[model samples]
Target chain A: MTGAPMPRLPTGIAWLDRLTHGGIPARRLTVLLGQAGAGKTLLSCQIAAARARVEGAGTVFAALEEPPADIIRNAAGFTWDLAALAGEHFHPLDLRPDPDMVFAGDFDLRGMLATLSAKARQTGAGLVVLDGLDTVLGWLASPARRSAELARIGRWLEEEGLTAIVTAKAERHGGPADALGPLEFAVSLVVALERREESGGTLRALRITKSRGSAHSSSAHPLFFSHNGLEPLMWPGGDAPPASQERVGSGMARLDALLGGGYLRGSTALLSGPPGTGKSTLAALFAASICAGGGRAVHVAFDEGPEQSIRNMRSVGIDLAAHRASGALRLIGLQPGRDGPEQLLSEILAAVETQDATALVVDPVSSLMRGGVADLGQSAVRRLVEEARARGMTAVLTSLVEIGEDPASGTLSAVSTIADAWIALGYAERGGERNRTLSIVKARGSAHSNQTREFVMSSEGCTLADVYTAGGAVLLGTARMEREAEERRLETLAALDHQRRLRALEAQLTEAELRQRRSALESEAARAELALLEAAEAERRAAQAERQARTAASRSADTPAEEGASA
Target chain B: MSAAAVALFVAGGAPRSAAALRNLTAAIAATGRPEGTFRVEVIDVLREPGRALEAGLLATPSLALTAPHGRRRWFVGEFDQPELLAGWLGDVLDGEPP
Candidate 1:
């Protein structure tokens, strides 16, 4: 060991490289321990092929258990062309023991080492893979001998300045030589592959049990075997996509209004509801919205195939088929039972990459939980959302909640907790009909409506209408329609009654005006009559006074007239 | 006369290779085979590593025996037990010969 740090050789697998903190230490012995059929051989071959293909570094692959031809054939199944890399940059040595060969007294691995060294020299190999080392160790009768051989191999690898990968079978039930046996102490790095039978399917995980002089992830990472090769699924812990302030439409204007300007770009939105509650329809609408805006979108349908999803969405006026035909949308249908969460995520991510999608919709993401590994599914969904956000893609994920199950609880809540917006869809059963209802349970950093709108889907499109509340109960379906009609009727009757009362008040005012006019006229006539009577009386009095004055005294008449005038 | 070919693969003059070669010679002498009946070839893997790889040698001091009928048998390790080596050679040489 030197004071200088060991240089790293990347395995060409992104997540694996990240897990090992830059891949295995170069020119050091690394051991792979796994049970039978646990992909030890495949992984080692991939590492060798990657070294040859990526760095163009020469590599030697020693097949101790299988023939070189079989290794080559199996390598062809992957995307790498191992057969073409043979003889120049890549050298394969068949060291499988002959069945007829017998051990005489004592032997070492000198012949095998010599052959390897020769091949390494020929190709200038920088890496060597001793696949199925357990088979070679099995030939030895004693554990001490096996340990010695392993140490010898390790020293030889170090002296040759070659990175080496040795694979061995992991024993079960804590046997004396369980798995690593004495080889664990001989290598600088140890990677263990595991296969567990889950209710959904077989789950494969890779864990780095030991790494000397390097910081690495200690937890087991789910493995996905795609056409390319094995990939470790991990939530990237790198520079996250900057928080986007942009908002994108959810296709339905009213729904957008409820969400306070639609969904935030590069954010995750959870649409949770029971079956037939239009969760898929809403997700499709989101996808269609992105596509209609000339943005590429990916819709992963877990419950149905692409054609079925297209047809079903078409019935709800969410023309997904049109978007798909226009190359703006890609539909990926996955069966939960067929693959684990890792494979599903890989496929979905692959689709996103190929389509260069900016928006993604996973209909009923809760279906991933059916794999019987809740933790795995949850982590996978988290990774999916994180990856989507890292690319600044708006992700609309649908989760299926049991009919009476609370959307805020259960396994689906794990998804909702990470989502920026959570829209809970349910059935508001009233009047013998179950009407779909949607409520924005949460919309972070936005002023969203708290009302639960009645979600209606028709041949035209999906729409959100205000839910009618009568008394204390929320009305929906035909009950809401009937209530609206009754309110309209009551309004009309009230209007008519008001009009009648106004007309009667107007008549009363008119009559009162006419009566006041008649009274004034009568008063004026009475006054005039009184004045005429008075004048007549005055004339009569004047006549009588004149007769009396003519008889008594003209002077008294004059005085009376003067007194009257003074009064 | 039977023509049986035997090849010895060793890692150049190592102590194990010398012991294996000496034991093999003594074992053949004990088999009492005619001199022309066997053709022996000694290949030092350290000197000619390609020959060792071409022979699919997995250990030093390995003995590869081929009969006239092309039937082959391989033995690995130094033949420190001369009797065991002699018996194995006798079985191969006593087989159907050309």
Candidate 2:
């Protein structure tokens, strides 16, 4: 093999194909290893059916453990119509061993191999699935014989140029080496399916453990079983979706203003608070706003049913039921403890895709971590947020923080780190009442307010009120109202005091003016008295001169002398 | 038609197939049954692979016995122990009416 790339047969599953780089290597043997009920058989059948249906390639499906009828019946549960292609394009071989089979001497699988080769030639099958090889290997009586038979089968497959999938049970102890034996060394690729019980439900994961020529994803991808088939939840690999600059409303204008003009489109917002802090209410409002704008939204309620959520949101004036009725909003209710995080994430993503929604709300996302592994829950949430962002869908997740617990330190921390905006709702107890308070902890790519506003919910909807700070104490509820009233009263009294001081100053000015007028009148009287006295004195002097008329010559001489003295 | 039918499946001219055929003939002779009582047929799997598959043959050099009532018994391998093969054939033949 001169370093030529191996051709691939696409599995028709997007995520699985991506996981395998292109798909399982074509015309090569691929071994599927898993424990019982690990979905090995289903996966093998799916591949076979997909090859037949999608590529129109003939396929041979041989069931050694399960009867061919049972396999076909089980496959019918999915959307694949295997019955139509049963005879012409798809050949099912029943190779289940007889229960009473006796081995008298040495034997080999040559007969079965020859039969398979003949069948392949007849149907022109490019792919063959040997399900439950472990069951067949159990009959070989010795490990050496099993190995020989497996090697023979591998040779036969290669000689026939058939792309084969051989499924075997993984041993409980040791590793694939123990169960797979010689088959492990023969196949070009080995895919492992794992089913583990986490919390209350089972989680299925698929990993490509060995790929001889291809660069495949090493991480185990979560598997989801839907109506169509097994779908692997691809991790948000590669570069993140391009950041969006558009803004989306938070339904309430005040809250939007607090958030610096609502949330950024394609960004994730985490609403964390204790119980009854209106986290769900805020999430519902956000979803309702999206739907009200003629856009689709998916609200996944982990804590409550759809009806209960709708009924509860009604009290806050958010009519989610109407949006749901209008087909703009899809309300999905899931019990957190009933399923693992992967299942929840799958359902959420499915809903978003089916609804073509632009906004997603996982109300009380913290519930996912309650009874599950913390790391799995965190990854699931991260994947969900990343996927939503990749599709330019705004995601609003709510986390319930215990009262008095720091939201930044515990389970919410993981989610908060990924959230584009984090709104922490809290209770401020003052004046014998606990009032809801909401503060923006962080909002990336936008200028947000740092104030902790009082969050109020009424029949109208959710609103943010400016919190009052009096004497260095944050006042809320009746305390703020009382403080406001007291300040108004003080203002009124100060106004009256100013009026009184003005009147007193006016009185003082009038008194000063009256006193000046009195003084002027007194000066006028004094001047008049002086004039009268002078006139009287002149008249007396004249009279005396007249009396001295007899001495007129002397008066005339005195007057002539006074006149000469004046000159 | 014989009351009982026996088949010896073999891969063409393999030693095991020859030995199994020889052992089957000897076992039938040791049963002391009349010639017309049992019908023996030799099938080469290489020549007739479809018949081998129809017979549910996983290995070559196998023996199959069918009584008149449609009861069948399959024994695998080359039948190295002749006496054991004879005893098994005798028991199977005894189940049929003489």
Candidate 3:
């Protein structure tokens, strides 16, 4: 367990070896433990082939449960040339127990160990694997016997300077150590493989339960074994990618404003809403915007198939299909009951790696929880967001609030908590009309509009518009229209009244002007008549004067005579 | 040499085993044979354990290749890689299958 770090023996699966800090330390006993169907035997063969091909190390594999032919045949399926590598660098020994063989008194793995040892020595093998040692170990009567036998095997392997990998079935319900018991302590490394339920299927993961000589990742990293081989799913360094200061637009311009520009690049946003409340539409819009900006995006749909999703989003003015065709976007659909959560995460990672995706959309993360692994679903989603953000990609996820459930709580509620920004969409009814409304519940590291704005969905896309709350209540749809109509009516009435008053004032002004003009005319008329009369009078007077003068002269003559008479 | 057909039976417990079938068939097909010259069948032993037992398949991913010349080859474990399976098949018939 101690010494200068043993020489690293790479497992040939890059991620697996990386997590192990290097493969099993050379010439040390390493135990690979998993359930009955965890593919331990296949892994053993892969190890043999890898050691033979990569390190050019002489290897020997002892199959305890499977026949050598089956091992060779199955190895071929993985493209391993086990047979050719054998007789020179690789030696495979079949150790299936015979049904006819009668056990004499005390049956132990001594005979098996002897055969394995002889084969290793004969081939000068540096690496050896005992596939299905649990079956042999299980035959032992007691834990003590198991411990002794494991110690004996460990010592022998060490003495021969040969690295040995032993496969064992994990206990159904116990600590990881239960599968190996004392043997777990005997081995220098213990790798446990398990299958976990995802959305519609199962995912395989591996954990380094123990590794003596090197620091190894103890996390249960997702495992992939194809015709290829076994490896972990975790990104190296086991952390999210570095955050970027740049911001990317969410398709809707108004929504971008609500989000303080747009979602920050490499940030995670959760859009939670009731069904038919445009949750998916928002995610699609984000993806479409990314695609439009010449950035690649990946959309994983759980509620519908890619075709249906594409059609549905297209109807909302988000042309996901076009982006998909142009290779700027990838659309993946998972059936809740048909695909596991781990499987979903792996495909997401594949998209990120293969396409160098800068944006990801998982519509209705709630559907993934239908697999009943709510916690696992959250973890998987968190990892997806982390990986996307780590690579400076923006991830927009949607979760549907089931009917009658609180809009804020769902299977992926944790997503809202982990997301850098959270947006909630819901239906608001006012005066018998239902309209969608969006609220920015939380936006980390940025100022965001907290007002509940009206959300409109159309073939042109989604937009957030001002909501009228003039009446001490938020108005939407028909109610707002009605209020607007009423205001217009009042405005028209007031304008008419204003016009009536203006006309009356104009009439009064005209009348006053007429009165004043008439008065002046009357006065002028009077003056003119007076002047004419005066002139006439004067003429009369003058005429009279002339007559009077004449008469006066005559009167004077008459008056003078009368006056002389009166005097 | 005569034509041969291979049947691979596996338990559904291991997801990798199913993936292995694809590689197994690809190898058998890579022998320069005409289409339909040989057939490879995959049987999920979990669903048809009775049939698997009748065929004497003892483990998951058991393969039994039966040639028209009364030649039968059986193997166990992961043999999805082509080199060894093809080598064994070539050596068994000494050439191409009919």
Which prediction has the highest TM-score against the true structure?
Answer: 1
| lDDT-best of 2 and 3 | 2
Off by over 4 Å in 1: A1-4, A72-90, A173-181, A198-200, A215-218, A233-248, A253-266, A334-357, A390-393, A427-436, A444-458, A463-567, B1-3, B96-98
iRMSD, per candidate, in listed order: 2.6, 3.1, 15.4
- The TM-scores of all predictions, comma-separated, are 0.77, 0.74, 0.59
On DockQ, the stronger of 2 and 3 is 2
Candidate 1, position A369, lDDT: 57
lDDT tens string, model 1, A318-386?
A: 788888899999998889867777678778877888799999998878876566477778877877778
Q: Pick the candidate with the highest lDDT.
A: 1
Task: Give the CA lDDT, 0 to 100, for residue A448 in model 2.
Answer: 90
Lowest lDDT 10-residue stretch of candidate 3 chain A? A99-108
> Between candidates 1 and 2, which one is better according to TM-score?
1
Worst 10 residues of 1 chain B by lDDT: B89-98
RMSD of 2: 9.9
Task: Score each candidate by Cα lDDT.
Answer: 0.81, 0.80, 0.72
The digit string of per-residue lDDT tens for model 2 on A1-567 reads 428777887876556666777777777778888888888888887877777677788878887889888887877856677777688777889888766555676666677666677778778888888888777666566777777777777787667787788888887521364535665556788888888877545777887888887666667777767645676554524467688888899988998887778999999999999899999999999999999998899999986799999999999899999999999999998998777776677677778888999999998888766665666677678877777888899999999889878756877998999889999998988767999989999999889988788889999878887677878777788887887889899999999999999999999999999999999999999999999999999998887666555454755654533322332
* Error at A349, model 3, angstroms: 4.8
